[model samples]
Target chain A: MYDGIVQDLIDELGRLPGVGPKSAQRIAFHIIQTESFDVDRLATILQTVRERVRFCIICGNIGEEERCAICRDPRRVPTAICVVEEAKDVVAIERTREYRGLYHVLGGALNPMQGIGPDQLRVAQLMTRLQDPTVEEVIIATDPNVEGEATATYLIRSLLPLGVRVSRLASGLPVGGDLEFADEMTLGRAFEGRRTVER
Target chain B: MYDGIVQDLIDELGRLPGVGPKSAQRIAFHIIQTESFDVDRLATILQTVRERVRFCIICGNIGEEERCAICRDPRRVPTAICVVEEAKDVVAIERTREYRGLYHVLGGALNPMQGIGPDQLRVAQLMTRLQDPTVEEVIIATDPNVEGEATATYLIRSLLPLGVRVSRLASGLPVGGDLEFADEMTLGRAFEGRRTVER
Candidate 1:
């Protein structure tokens, strides 16, 4: 047990994903020991983000305005839209600098056990966006896990009838990882997606 | 790279102690996805703590007013004071429900490499507190590691001249711990601190 304020902080931190009770305690204690200015800055930013930031009306990505930057950028390819499970996935894909298209954040993947389904996601809005005459392709960039795979499959089936070219990101062994340590599914995918080497 | 605001949030989270860039990224994403009400609650509490909490002038623990609850409580023995390095240490000691004395938070332990000396600590304030006529005993509850041990030794040397009784927390094997698995120092401490059982 800890002091009331410290316990409150730990409880709030523990509610975060991947943060256990021990981690929450450690962080709470660290915050208590840190300078008040630093803690105030963090608190200010936390409040500012919640107050000034919101999901883009066009795509579910976070932004200060109604639409995300990519959605407003004329240079980005409006013909193709990459769909992801969360706003973070959009950032992850952007880091590659390979896509020149817009994004549609589904908020979360379909997890029946968690009671999250297609109705709970922004799938209907995505369908509405696909109705634009300029749109041609939809890239499903959901995570390669079971839930992600299920969501992608469901989206592909639904998008096929709309006459849009639907695709999923390839799955394989990670770069810089040893082939010997690769799991069977990843190694198999790497073999299946093998490309010809240029001399 | 993420949106500027998202990046700012990640950077702020990364500044927290023990939170690496990867962990910060994870936490930032988790925060973004969390329910708006939960995020708002965290923001509110963070602001409340920063605005309302202040250090107790007497014991240095966080509180709303001049003195912390522990220091203000008349039930606690004001005649004895336990010295510790940080406010978190005071909370840790209180959880045991063993000692019933007031506390003196020294802010940090003595570390020569880091250039932290007695001058940087609250040792002077502790001595001032000891000058009170009713004070009879001082408990050196600094940590057991190198810096803590050094601090305890320093406190013992400094406090002995004041004619006040000084005691260190007993060192021994932890309750419910295996004797064979205990480290040599712990096992030796347990043997040295062996007590007669009332059979």
Candidate 2:
């Protein structure tokens, strides 16, 4: 029911993971109401990023250059690499401010039902990278979901023969959530990873 | 923790109404993953709409030219006009096959707390439009909220002396809503609007 350009915008917005038709319409109206200069700047940045940004050859993170900033940073621990399923995960981990290691994006997690296998990921590339004597530890930071766990299991099995230290992110009850409201998996993990109180 | 361009994109996306920082980050990542051609097209359209779209002088609806499509259409009934709070409301009414009348978008509803008054709206323009002898009826289709009710009341009072028929959209139980679970206001409306059944 919208004009041609507006409809195109709504259609494109609806293609996003969580945005629905109503939300697409709302966003389109918002964009239409915004000032020309502001909208134009957004458009310019979108186009610019599309033209300049590409996956980092070393770690698969998004970057305008051949190497991502994390890959090139000299202060980052070269001996330790954190493996994740996607580039977005790298950003998530970076926000925590705890990890100073490098990253290796696997492109996607293994899902045999959807035909995504080990070959589809950068597993071989990761194995080759680990062959370097400077690399010491590999931390698997995939999502705590089924596909993520399966991918981590596959990685651990493949990497064990290489003699590198392998680790996975600890699972437990999230802080601030009520125990009664916690899901079975989380509660089970909390039980498994329980710690003794020293104080 | 993100690169400067990615942060810029996230900030810009966050400026849109209803889009939080987390949603903005997700949208930015989705945009980054999209093909260059698709991203360029969306960016180009955003710029094009910003540069070309303008408010119709007579009706206040968005248009590329001086007048909106509805204002230019000769077949629409000139004797009756549907007044709404926003341009999106006009689109919503047009989707139904019911109304063949013209439209008058009021920019926004009356709200004293928000500093919006009749002067802030297109009430003066609406009055001018009604001055034409061809106009006979004005349908107030504002939202079913406090601000909309106040605007409708104000319009009815103003238009009574002009010798034009004024009507408000009926408020009652929604089509898909359960009568037993409906709120007091909606249930009260349903009772007030009760009609004799033809048994």
Q: Give the top-scoring candidate (DockQ).
A: 2
Pairs of residues at least 3 apart in sequence or in different chains that clash in candidate 1? none
lDDT of 2 by residue, A16-78 (tens): 656888778778878887554387788888877777778999998888789999999999999
lDDT of 2 by residue, B34-66 (tens): 664387777887877776777889889877789
- Going through the candidates in order, their DockQ values are 0.42, 0.57
TM-score of each: 0.79, 0.85
Q: Judged by TM-score, which candidate is best?
A: 2
Q: Estimate the TM-score for candidate 2.
A: 0.85
Pairs clashing in candidate 2? none
User: What's the TM-score of chain B for every model shown?
Assistant: 0.84, 0.85
Predict model 2's lDDT versus the native: 0.76
lDDT of 1 at A7: 73
- Model 1, position B198, has a per-residue lDDT of 16
Write one digit per residue (lDDT tens) for candidate 1, span A1-199: 5546667888998887678876786677677665653766676677677777789999988888888887888999889888888886676566555678899999888999999999999999999998897898787767666787788788888888887777665556464432223454554454345332211
Q: TM-scores for chain A, candidates in order?
A: 0.83, 0.84
Question: Among all windows of ten consecutive residues in candidate 1 chain A, which has the lowest summed lDDT?
Answer: A190-199
